[model samples]
Target: MTLNRSIGILALICLPAAGIWFWQNPTVRQAPQLSFKTIKGERIDLADLKGKLVLVTFWATDCPGCIEEIPHLVELHRQYSNAGLTIIAVAMYYDPPNRVMAMAKAKQLPYAVALDPSGSLAQGFGNVQLTPTTFLIDRTGRIVLQNTGAFELQDIRQRLNQL
Candidate 1:
């Protein structure tokens, strides 16, 4: 193979490998402070959820993968909330606010939902440029996992089991 072609193949292979490593063994990161009003006009903040495991997801209404993840998120919240788990779904700025709100309502999502007008919230989470990115934060308010794309639900549950 040509040198450039070889390098391209290697990059394609290694980049995702690195992302998986980052996702599974995320270094402890102090979660970016978050405070926002939900679509239901309820205010929420990470600080307020101290001592609770939290999952913050960045998504858009038009993203099928994001839509696919909602039921899993709802299940997680319902099963774990009393045990101190919290979830916040932040809708990406490009999606119309009305549609975002509609999706949350139609799904009857059990977690907090916030709309980003200009993607600032996603930027704080490492400039999330895609739909369905998720971060799992520990009870101590540090991010323990970061997954982009269609995150495996079983993997997430396994990680939570560890914590």
Candidate 2:
């Protein structure tokens, strides 16, 4: 092989290896520092939950998809909360606090229901603009998964198991 051709081949191999190393590095994708104010006047700091797997879900009361996922989320919480999974359902800034509270009550949500009235929570989570944006963060505070809309519950369960 020509010198340039050999160098090109080496570059192709090394670049992908470097990319994979960077992507897989746990320190590269840490979740942002954020604190949530739950509906019942409770403060939850993400940093405090470092040793626990956390599922932070951005939702709106008026969102059909968000509403649809509640039952599955509730079940997930039921099955996993005792296994060190903390689920936080965040109501978007545009969602009225009263409506969020009413839905939380009506649905009998078992997990923490937070209010994002100023949209800061969404902003901290990569400026999330859509309802039902969910993030699965590992015990070490690395964000393992980010889903924009509806997600597969089984897949989430598998991930939770692995984490």
Candidate 3:
């Protein structure tokens, strides 16, 4: 093959890999605003949380993955909260409001926990349909990471540390 043809072939191969990387881990340029009355009755607003690293986590009470991820999230909250991280844990629509309330209380979740009873919260977040889907919004209010399924805590921590 000519040198030019080899370069073209390499470009073609790399293009698809780049596209897949962008597709699977897309950045949410401007995260839709979210305001919710947390299970604890305090109102939290995404817009109001500017200048802080925000983790908008969507989880359901019944999801085993969600259950397993809480402790790690709590530790993240503990490690980073005072340093500028804020996590808003939202219970997914399928989980009953009462159950969400019960679980939040039972867990004694250190961070704010909100119930998506009307499904509005999840809908605002691109119609979030999966449990343990998390978005990491940068300090300037732009969402930089969208994670679906159980959080890869080590990966997440690395990203968090970079911010």
Candidate 4:
């Protein structure tokens, strides 16, 4: 009777923990729905890039880490762009569109960029608290990789090679 009771208690305890684990895991969550305006004032749907690897990077113009990461991202885009990779830089901070555009132009970024004025997309993607947070989505729209800090060029290349 004691063994049965202990097993029952264990089952009760483990069930909720497993439920929480599954809830918080990105693999279990639905692919975030993203729709925002590009720097050119055109609307873009995240789903539109199906069948290609998508690199969605959340950044702010004033963030030091973000500033440092842009050049690496640009280089990554340049290197892998012909290999079916699409890099999208999403400016999440509340900055003027012209300011963001000017910065992009100054940096000579070759990838596409969009402004998240409402910040809804960031919130939907799990509140993305840090600047330079990057998400690597596979061809099927699954978030295969998520990095919360700056990434090295070789690291990105290695990850892309797996996809």
lDDT of 2 by residue, 1-163 (tens): 6999999999999999999876754343799999999999999999999999999999998888998899889999999999999999999999999999999999999999999888899999899999899999999999988888987899899889888
Clashing pairs in 1: none
- Tell how far residue 48 is off in model 1, in angstroms: 1.9
Which sections of candidate 4 miss by over 4 Å? 1-30
lDDT of 3 by residue, 1-163 (tens): 6999999999999999999988966875888887978887899889999899999899988889999999999999999999889888998777888998888888889998888888998899888898889999998899889988888889889998998
Worst 10 residues of 3 by lDDT: 24-33
Question: How does each model score on lDDT?
Answer: 0.88, 0.91, 0.89, 0.83
Candidate topping lDDT: 2
User: Candidate 3: deviation at residue 107, Å?
Assistant: 1.5
Q: Per-residue lDDT for 1-163 in model 4, tens only?
A: 9999999999999999999876644453345868867887777677887788889899988889899998898888988899999888999858677888999999988988898888887897888778889888888888877778887778779889988
> Candidate 1 at 37: error in angstroms?
1.6
Model 4 worst lDDT window (10 residues): 22-31
Error of 3 at 14 (Å): 9.1
Task: Show model 1 residue runs off by greater than 4 Å.
Answer: 1-23
TM-score between model 3 and native: 0.85
Candidate 1 C-alpha lDDT tens digits along 45-151: 88887788999999999899998999899888888888888889999889899998888889999899998897889888889989899999998889888888978
| Residue 2 of model 2, lDDT score | 100
User: Where is model 2 poorest over a 10-residue stretch in terms of lDDT?
Assistant: 20-29
Model 2: lDDT equals 0.91
TM-score of candidate 2 versus the correct structure, residues matched by position:
0.84
Question: 54 in model 4: Cα distance from truth in Å?
Answer: 0.2
Q: Give per-residue lDDT, candidate 4, residue 130.
A: 87
User: lDDT of candidate 1 vs native?
Assistant: 0.88
